[model samples]
Target: MTGSTEASLRVEVLGSQHDRNSFECGVEPLDRYLRMQAGQDARKNIAAPFVLVMPDGAIAGYYTLSSTAVSVGEWPVETVRKLPRYPLIPATLLGRLAVDRRQQGRGYGRYLLADALLRSLRSEIAAFAVIVNAKDGNARRFYQRESFLPFPDQPMKLFRPMADIAELFR
Candidate 1:
């Protein structure tokens, strides 16, 4: 498609028809997960992988969402004080996210992220936030730019409250 833009992209559940082999975001772990484990995870109900598809059916980017939990103690005191006294808080894990190397600079990462957050917010299951474990400093910075906050003790692990994310879409 000529004059293509991110708006022209569509996000859908990853399926056998989607070509995962050619998706490379210059990250080996992320690439391998998508190509090998993503389908298995989906089948096992461990995670739901969504792919950003071009008009020609090429996979430009993908992300996985799964149910998770975090200890209340892991949250900052200021944040935890307002929350329930439960030992663990429900969350949605953004397990893996990556864009094809060719699509890296085209804003597909953020686009996939937005779609993931919105999906989490819309889910009937209760989740206080969306959490991500950044693979490195650069990934951490990326999530931080999108308003994700690093846990006080775990800089690579970050979260953005569902309420705040809801406000973003509104």
Candidate 2:
């Protein structure tokens, strides 16, 4: 499936035990970034994982969203001072995102991310930004192409303010 052909694609969240496993096996990136960190991050309330399933019940892709704390010092001074000192501002971290090899090139990854972002916007999560640590140069490029900005000090990391993402849906 590719391009316009995917207009009718059916994508939904993984909601069952089998679906979770399938989603795990379908994407290594998800496994590395989220599943492996499930114990330490997820259980500790640091992050949450979500999966995208196709109509046939096959796992197409997966992503993780989590609450993160960024120091006011990490942000530009202009943006930092505007925020309260030591504020635990809401943040959504895209811990991992991957499309199955079999489903690659179908734009499923974009769909998966869009779903995650939309959910964040709608939820009362209070996230000020969505952050992603790209696994490699390719992943970094992908996020950058999607309008995420790379941190000056950390090129592999990309971020998009929630307000900026919300504007896209308008």
Candidate 3:
């Protein structure tokens, strides 16, 4: 299926033979991590992965969403103080996001992210925030551009309030 826009791309949840092959070709590191998670029986903790395929049927990129828990202490004090003294809150984790080297600079990564956030918004799992551990400066910058705020203690990690993200869909 083609994307709705001119730079048409298809985004689908990962499954099946074709999806596996596309994931391997596009983002082997992410694929390896997913396999490891599956081997460790941690797949139950994660939402399904999704992949973006170009019109030519090549995987352009992929991302995975997962249910996660975060302690109130982990958040900024300003945000934490507003909530009741619960030990932890349910959160959504963007576990892996990668683009094929060949597909880099084509805006497929942005497309993959937009698709991921849209799906997350529709999920039944309760999530007060979306969190990501950015792998590098470039990755960090990408999330920053999308309005994700850096964790005060861990600059490499970033988060977006679910309310802010929801407004984007409006």
Model 2: clashing residue pairs?
none
lDDT per residue, candidate 3, 123-147, as tens digits? 8888988899998888899999999
lDDT of 2 by residue, 1-170 (tens): 55554665555533434244444434465655533554455557666666666657666777777777665556655556667666566678887788867777877888888988888788786877888899888899899889998766778877788889989899
For model 2, the stretches where C-alpha displacement exceeds 4 angstroms are: 1-13, 20-29, 32-46, 81-84
Clashes of 2: 0
lDDT of 1 by residue, 1-170 (tens): 23466557899999999999998999899999999999999999999999999978899999999999999999988999889999999999999999999888877888899999999999999999999999999999999999999999999999999999999999
Backbone clash numbers for all candidates listed: 0, 0, 0
Task: List TM-scores for all candidates, in order.
Answer: 0.96, 0.79, 0.83
Best by lDDT: 1
Q: How high a TM-score does candidate 2 get?
A: 0.79
Q: In model 2, where is the ten-residue run with the lowest total lDDT?
A: 13-22
Model 2 Cα displacement at 66 (Å)? 1.1
Error of 3 at 92 (Å): 0.4
